[model samples]
Target: MARNPARRAALVDAAIEVLAHEGARGLTFRAVDAQAAVPAGTASNYFADRDDLLNQAGRHIHVRLAPEESALAELMDAPRSRELVYRLMRDLVARMLGDRAGYLALLELRLEATRRPALRAALTRTLRENLKRNVDFHREAGLPDDGDTVLRLYFSITGLLVEYLTAPGVLDEHELDDLVGILVDSALGIGPHHR
Candidate 1:
């Protein structure tokens, strides 16, 4: 129903803000419209229903948080090493911290998905694809590529990021480095002092 892509994107972004601040229950067309500073009922024009808005918001968060292709390409071209792995992990943490609102909204979406079958299906598919892509990227980058290794690394980093974002000061940047180092070292089966 969205006539313009930009308008729809704006609506989605507004929906994310509303979800992050007001929680899923508070997300209404009126709330999104108000958050967007658009005319009343404007959000309804872009989305068929609240589910559509929530789904779009999920996609928007992923799109906004996805790393730039150029940055990925640069990493891909760089020499593969423990140092590079650490940098990649650091970048992920920085991105999470950089867009705390979007990440929080993403968490809200996960909670909402628990009750909405349709949303759950869509989110599950999206997350699966993301994991597959991440696995492929790691293989291409010459990093740990075994299924269990990749999954453990993924879940470990994900948990760390969620905790860090949800509760600030739980871990400082230096501590994060130590954690990342431990994870990377463990995944690679390297010693503590190694890169």
Candidate 2:
């Protein structure tokens, strides 16, 4: 039977809450059902198994990063795309560090999905789409359009975030901005011997 989307959404929401609050180790259908104020069987009706529930939750969180249409428009019109980009990434790093334990749980889910063939493929596809969107945003912001270049910068930033978050007091916003500023300068045709 086709499930009720509204109710399913509610369950997914509850699942995210549970995943955030309890970690993947604590997530269970009964807890989700209880969180959603539904019968255990009700959750089963929507998600037949644990992996199904997790995949849905992962997709829900993953979509939050999508850049498309109006999302791209917002990026295009922002004042000082470089600053805006740096701020956004900085804020995410701050949050990731702030709730290191909980966010680490979510990160574990992503890592676990890496070893699961089907989920890994799906994750790779989603990440590729997002990477393309991010590269396009960089081009629109007058940055270099080379995918490999943009991806390298992206990984560098993410790596810095992870390093700082894990090591504590090892990374700061000033350093992050400095690095991004260098990239922006290169991308914006501001360099010695500019043509």
Candidate 3:
């Protein structure tokens, strides 16, 4: 373990890029070092092993993908309504799409977690905590929907992101906004009878 925080962060970020493009099997100390443009042994100094690198990469991707504080504050300041929820969901999609590499790295971490118990536990904890935070935020902000709606939106958005990222042509880009609107409406139970 190296004591240099900046270098360690750099290595982990590089590891994320490697994982995103090369998959778990292609992630190695040398590969990370090359990705980071550092000396050949630099990554090994920062991480104990491949598992350590993998875990750190997973954490880093979440940090990268988290919404900006300013954006969250702006959202909270707005009137809480179904329209707000729709805007939030649209922003979520834009944010995820903006950082395709980070989301792809997260997807890769998910696949690698299936084979590594430690990684699986770590990733599960991280994701659950994130989900809890989002649910809490939605409730605290006096949003129109409950936590269940938030959870459903989370799943729907995740599936949409996966399909859009991994199989780009499968989803029509022009209809994405409409699709997100439908997901929000369905989750909030806003039908012809209800607002």
Best by lDDT: 3
Name the top TM-score candidate.
3
Tens-digit lDDT track for model 1 on 1-195? Answer: 759888888889999989989999999999999999999989988899999888888878998888888987786676777678777877887787788888889999999999999999988988899999888878866875455667777888888878877885777555777887788777767788765
* Model 3 steric clash pairs: none
TM-score computed on alpha carbons, candidate 2: 0.67
Off by over 4 Å in 3: 192-195
**lDDT of candidate 2?**
0.65
Residues 3-98, model 3: lDDT tens digits: 999999998889988988999999999999999999999998888999999999988998989889999779767788998998899999999999
What are the runs in model 1 whose C-alpha is more than 4 Å off?
172-174
lDDT of 2 by residue, 14-120 (tens): 78778767777777889899989987677878887888887787676654333346745664566755456555455545555555544444565677676676666
- Model 2, which residues run further than 4 Å from truth? 66-75, 78-106, 145-147, 164-195
Per-model TM-score versus the true fold:
0.92, 0.67, 0.95
The C-alpha lDDT values of all candidates are 0.84, 0.65, 0.89
lDDT winner, 1 or 3: 3
